[model samples]
Target: MKSVDATEFRVGGSDGWTVTTSFNYNQWAEKNRFQVGDSLLFDYDSGKDSVYQVNKEDYDKCHTEKPIETYKDGHTSIKLDETGTLYFISGNCGNCRKNEKMVVQVMACRGSCNSAASLGYLSCLGVVGAFVASLLL
Candidate 1:
Protein backbone atom coordinates (compact mmCIF):
# COMPACT_ATOMS: atom_id res chain seq x y z
CA MET A 1 0.00 0.00 0.00
CA LYS A 2 1.23 3.44 -0.84
CA SER A 3 1.56 5.76 2.09
CA VAL A 4 0.59 9.37 1.40
CA ASP A 5 4.12 10.48 2.29
CA ALA A 6 6.09 10.50 -0.92
CA THR A 7 7.53 13.99 -1.50
CA GLU A 8 9.17 15.87 -4.31
CA PHE A 9 11.59 18.62 -3.26
CA ARG A 10 12.09 21.64 -5.43
CA VAL A 11 15.81 22.25 -5.87
CA GLY A 12 16.96 25.72 -4.79
CA GLY A 13 13.53 26.41 -3.33
CA SER A 14 11.37 28.99 -5.10
CA ASP A 15 14.34 30.42 -6.96
CA GLY A 16 14.83 27.10 -8.76
CA TRP A 17 18.26 26.29 -10.21
CA THR A 18 20.06 29.30 -11.64
CA VAL A 19 23.37 31.15 -11.48
CA THR A 20 23.05 33.88 -8.90
CA THR A 21 25.52 35.29 -6.42
CA SER A 22 22.89 35.47 -3.71
CA PHE A 23 21.71 31.87 -4.01
CA ASN A 24 23.76 29.36 -2.10
CA TYR A 25 22.93 25.77 -3.11
CA ASN A 26 25.16 24.15 -0.52
CA GLN A 27 23.43 26.05 2.24
CA TRP A 28 20.09 25.14 0.78
CA ALA A 29 21.06 21.44 0.70
CA GLU A 30 22.35 21.55 4.26
CA LYS A 31 18.95 22.70 5.45
CA ASN A 32 17.09 19.70 4.08
CA ARG A 33 17.08 15.98 4.79
CA PHE A 34 16.79 13.52 1.95
CA GLN A 35 15.82 9.85 2.08
CA VAL A 36 15.35 6.97 -0.27
CA GLY A 37 12.09 7.12 -2.26
CA ASP A 38 12.01 10.90 -2.26
CA SER A 39 12.38 12.92 -5.43
CA LEU A 40 14.38 15.98 -6.42
CA LEU A 41 12.81 18.34 -8.90
CA PHE A 42 15.22 20.55 -10.77
CA ASP A 43 13.66 23.42 -12.62
CA TYR A 44 15.76 25.33 -15.15
CA ASP A 45 15.89 26.55 -18.70
CA SER A 46 16.85 23.68 -20.98
CA GLY A 47 17.96 26.05 -23.66
CA LYS A 48 20.74 27.48 -21.56
CA ASP A 49 21.31 25.12 -18.64
CA SER A 50 21.12 21.42 -17.87
CA VAL A 51 21.43 19.14 -14.84
CA TYR A 52 24.27 16.65 -14.60
CA GLN A 53 24.68 13.93 -12.01
CA VAL A 54 28.37 13.56 -11.31
CA ASN A 55 30.76 12.05 -8.83
CA LYS A 56 32.33 13.94 -5.94
CA GLU A 57 35.55 14.50 -7.84
CA ASP A 58 33.80 15.93 -10.87
CA TYR A 59 31.51 18.00 -8.72
CA ASP A 60 34.41 19.48 -6.81
CA LYS A 61 36.30 20.32 -10.00
CA CYS A 62 33.21 21.42 -11.91
CA HIS A 63 34.01 18.86 -14.59
CA THR A 64 31.28 18.42 -17.16
CA GLU A 65 33.22 16.17 -19.52
CA LYS A 66 31.47 13.07 -18.13
CA PRO A 67 28.29 12.81 -16.14
CA ILE A 68 26.75 9.75 -14.54
CA GLU A 69 23.43 10.95 -15.81
CA THR A 70 22.23 13.96 -17.77
CA TYR A 71 18.93 15.74 -17.91
CA LYS A 72 18.23 18.38 -20.52
CA ASP A 73 14.54 19.01 -20.10
CA GLY A 74 13.52 22.28 -18.52
CA HIS A 75 12.19 20.28 -15.57
CA THR A 76 13.93 17.16 -14.29
CA SER A 77 12.66 14.90 -11.54
CA ILE A 78 15.19 12.41 -10.18
CA LYS A 79 14.11 9.78 -7.70
CA LEU A 80 16.25 9.01 -4.69
CA ASP A 81 16.47 5.29 -5.22
CA GLU A 82 19.35 4.60 -2.87
CA THR A 83 20.77 5.76 0.41
CA GLY A 84 24.05 7.58 0.06
CA THR A 85 25.57 10.80 -1.17
CA LEU A 86 24.56 12.06 -4.59
CA TYR A 87 26.34 14.89 -6.35
CA PHE A 88 24.97 17.23 -8.96
CA ILE A 89 26.50 19.96 -11.07
CA SER A 90 25.57 22.24 -13.90
CA GLY A 91 26.40 21.28 -17.46
CA ASN A 92 27.84 24.75 -17.75
CA CYS A 93 31.30 24.32 -16.24
CA GLY A 94 31.52 28.06 -15.69
CA ASN A 95 28.32 28.13 -13.68
CA CYS A 96 29.31 25.01 -11.74
CA ARG A 97 32.62 26.60 -10.85
CA LYS A 98 30.60 29.49 -9.45
CA ASN A 99 29.09 27.06 -6.92
CA GLU A 100 25.97 25.91 -8.72
CA LYS A 101 26.41 22.38 -7.46
CA MET A 102 24.92 20.48 -4.54
CA VAL A 103 25.44 17.21 -2.73
CA VAL A 104 22.54 15.22 -1.30
CA GLN A 105 22.86 12.55 1.33
CA VAL A 106 19.98 10.12 1.20
CA MET A 107 19.40 8.55 4.53
CA ALA A 108 18.11 5.03 4.93
CA CYS A 109 14.39 4.65 5.47
CA ARG A 110 13.29 4.32 9.09
CA GLY A 111 10.31 3.42 11.25
CA SER A 112 7.10 2.33 9.60
CA CYS A 113 8.00 4.35 6.58
CA ASN A 114 10.81 1.94 5.85
CA SER A 115 8.54 -1.04 5.77
CA ALA A 116 6.08 0.80 3.58
CA ALA A 117 8.75 1.81 1.15
CA SER A 118 10.28 -1.65 1.17
CA LEU A 119 6.91 -2.97 0.12
CA GLY A 120 6.90 -0.49 -2.78
CA TYR A 121 4.47 1.93 -1.21
CA LEU A 122 5.68 5.21 -2.64
CA SER A 123 2.68 7.21 -1.52
CA CYS A 124 3.53 6.55 2.10
CA LEU A 125 7.14 7.40 1.42
CA GLY A 126 6.06 10.65 -0.12
CA VAL A 127 4.20 11.66 3.00
CA VAL A 128 7.22 10.87 5.13
CA GLY A 129 9.49 12.72 2.75
CA ALA A 130 7.29 15.79 2.91
CA PHE A 131 7.12 15.65 6.69
CA VAL A 132 10.90 15.39 6.98
CA ALA A 133 11.44 18.28 4.58
CA SER A 134 8.95 20.38 6.53
CA LEU A 135 10.77 19.78 9.80
CA LEU A 136 14.00 21.04 8.28
CA LEU A 137 12.35 24.16 6.88
Candidate 2:
Protein backbone atom coordinates (compact mmCIF):
# COMPACT_ATOMS: atom_id res chain seq x y z
CA MET A 1 0.00 0.00 0.00
CA LYS A 2 1.03 3.57 -0.66
CA SER A 3 2.04 5.70 2.29
CA VAL A 4 -0.51 8.25 3.45
CA ASP A 5 2.33 10.68 4.12
CA ALA A 6 3.03 11.09 0.44
CA THR A 7 3.56 14.52 -1.00
CA GLU A 8 1.39 15.90 -3.78
CA PHE A 9 2.92 18.28 -6.26
CA ARG A 10 1.03 20.83 -8.29
CA VAL A 11 2.22 20.33 -11.84
CA GLY A 12 3.76 23.46 -13.35
CA GLY A 13 3.73 25.06 -9.90
CA SER A 14 1.54 28.15 -9.56
CA ASP A 15 0.98 28.43 -13.30
CA GLY A 16 -0.62 25.01 -13.40
CA TRP A 17 -1.20 22.84 -16.48
CA THR A 18 -1.87 25.08 -19.45
CA VAL A 19 -0.77 26.02 -22.95
CA THR A 20 1.52 28.77 -21.77
CA THR A 21 4.47 28.11 -24.01
CA SER A 22 6.59 30.19 -21.67
CA PHE A 23 6.28 27.64 -18.88
CA ASN A 24 8.78 24.81 -18.97
CA TYR A 25 7.35 21.64 -17.49
CA ASN A 26 10.59 19.74 -17.96
CA GLN A 27 12.54 22.34 -16.02
CA TRP A 28 9.93 22.42 -13.30
CA ALA A 29 10.07 18.67 -13.01
CA GLU A 30 13.83 18.72 -12.62
CA LYS A 31 13.63 21.17 -9.72
CA ASN A 32 11.94 18.59 -7.50
CA ARG A 33 12.50 15.00 -6.46
CA PHE A 34 9.85 12.27 -6.71
CA GLN A 35 9.47 9.20 -4.54
CA VAL A 36 7.25 6.13 -4.75
CA GLY A 37 4.70 7.71 -2.42
CA ASP A 38 4.58 11.01 -4.28
CA SER A 39 1.70 12.18 -6.45
CA LEU A 40 1.30 14.74 -9.21
CA LEU A 41 -1.66 17.08 -9.46
CA PHE A 42 -2.44 18.40 -12.90
CA ASP A 43 -4.82 21.31 -13.05
CA TYR A 44 -6.14 22.55 -16.37
CA ASP A 45 -9.20 23.42 -18.37
CA SER A 46 -11.15 20.27 -19.17
CA GLY A 47 -12.87 21.95 -22.12
CA LYS A 48 -9.61 22.95 -23.78
CA ASP A 49 -6.84 20.80 -22.42
CA SER A 50 -6.12 17.33 -21.09
CA VAL A 51 -3.28 15.27 -19.61
CA TYR A 52 -1.80 12.11 -21.11
CA GLN A 53 0.70 9.73 -19.61
CA VAL A 54 2.70 8.35 -22.49
CA ASN A 55 5.88 6.52 -23.23
CA LYS A 56 9.17 8.29 -23.93
CA GLU A 57 8.71 7.85 -27.67
CA ASP A 58 5.22 9.31 -27.69
CA TYR A 59 6.21 12.13 -25.37
CA ASP A 60 9.05 13.16 -27.66
CA LYS A 61 6.85 12.93 -30.75
CA CYS A 62 3.81 14.58 -29.17
CA HIS A 63 1.73 11.54 -30.05
CA THR A 64 -1.50 11.53 -28.05
CA GLU A 65 -3.38 8.76 -29.78
CA LYS A 66 -1.47 5.99 -28.00
CA PRO A 67 -1.22 7.37 -24.51
CA ILE A 68 -0.48 4.90 -21.74
CA GLU A 69 -3.05 6.67 -19.57
CA THR A 70 -5.44 9.57 -20.20
CA TYR A 71 -6.90 12.16 -17.85
CA LYS A 72 -9.40 14.74 -19.02
CA ASP A 73 -11.18 15.86 -15.89
CA GLY A 74 -9.22 19.16 -15.78
CA HIS A 75 -7.93 18.13 -12.35
CA THR A 76 -5.95 14.94 -12.36
CA SER A 77 -3.98 13.36 -9.54
CA ILE A 78 -1.69 10.48 -10.34
CA LYS A 79 0.22 8.50 -7.73
CA LEU A 80 3.75 7.28 -8.15
CA ASP A 81 3.43 3.65 -7.16
CA GLU A 82 6.97 2.61 -7.99
CA THR A 83 10.40 3.88 -8.76
CA GLY A 84 11.37 4.65 -12.32
CA THR A 85 10.83 7.22 -15.02
CA LEU A 86 7.34 8.37 -15.94
CA TYR A 87 6.52 10.53 -18.94
CA PHE A 88 3.56 12.82 -19.39
CA ILE A 89 2.45 15.12 -22.15
CA SER A 90 -0.46 17.32 -23.08
CA GLY A 91 -3.35 15.88 -25.04
CA ASN A 92 -3.08 18.80 -27.39
CA CYS A 93 -0.23 17.80 -29.63
CA GLY A 94 0.34 21.44 -30.45
CA ASN A 95 0.78 22.31 -26.83
CA CYS A 96 2.98 19.29 -26.28
CA ARG A 97 5.14 20.35 -29.16
CA LYS A 98 5.44 23.72 -27.50
CA ASN A 99 6.98 22.14 -24.36
CA GLU A 100 4.03 20.82 -22.41
CA LYS A 101 5.65 17.58 -21.47
CA MET A 102 7.53 16.37 -18.40
CA VAL A 103 9.71 13.41 -17.59
CA VAL A 104 9.63 12.46 -13.92
CA GLN A 105 12.21 10.22 -12.30
CA VAL A 106 10.83 8.57 -9.19
CA MET A 107 13.24 7.19 -6.63
CA ALA A 108 12.75 4.54 -4.00
CA CYS A 109 12.11 5.62 -0.42
CA ARG A 110 15.29 5.62 1.60
CA GLY A 111 15.89 5.41 5.35
CA SER A 112 12.88 6.35 7.44
CA CYS A 113 11.28 8.82 5.07
CA ASN A 114 7.81 7.31 5.34
CA SER A 115 7.98 7.55 9.10
CA ALA A 116 8.90 11.22 9.14
CA ALA A 117 6.65 13.37 11.26
CA SER A 118 6.18 16.18 8.75
CA LEU A 119 5.83 15.73 5.01
CA GLY A 120 8.36 18.53 4.62
CA TYR A 121 10.95 16.25 6.21
CA LEU A 122 10.44 13.78 3.40
CA SER A 123 11.20 16.48 0.89
CA CYS A 124 14.29 17.41 2.85
CA LEU A 125 15.45 13.80 2.77
CA GLY A 126 14.93 13.74 -0.98
CA VAL A 127 17.13 16.78 -1.37
CA VAL A 128 19.75 15.14 0.79
CA GLY A 129 19.48 11.92 -1.18
CA ALA A 130 20.00 13.78 -4.41
CA PHE A 131 23.04 15.44 -2.98
CA VAL A 132 24.44 12.08 -1.88
CA ALA A 133 23.75 10.55 -5.29
CA SER A 134 25.43 13.44 -7.04
CA LEU A 135 28.52 13.01 -4.91
CA LEU A 136 28.71 9.29 -5.74
CA LEU A 137 28.24 10.00 -9.41
The lDDT of each candidate is: 0.84, 0.84
lDDT (tens digit, per residue) of candidate 1 on 7-66 = 799998887888988999888888888877789999999998999999999998999988
Tens-place lDDT digits, model 2, residues 16-135 = 898786788888889998887789999999998899999999988999999999999999999898889999999998889888889999988744444333444445658777466445
As for candidate 2, its clashing pairs are: none
lDDT (C-alpha) at residue 73 in model 1: 97
Report the poorest 10 consecutive residues by lDDT, candidate 2. 113-122
In model 2, the number of clashes is 0
Q: Which stretches of candidate 1 lie over 4 Å from their true place?
A: 1-4, 114-137
| Top-TM-score candidate index | 1
- Candidate 1 minimal-lDDT segment of 10 residues: 114-123
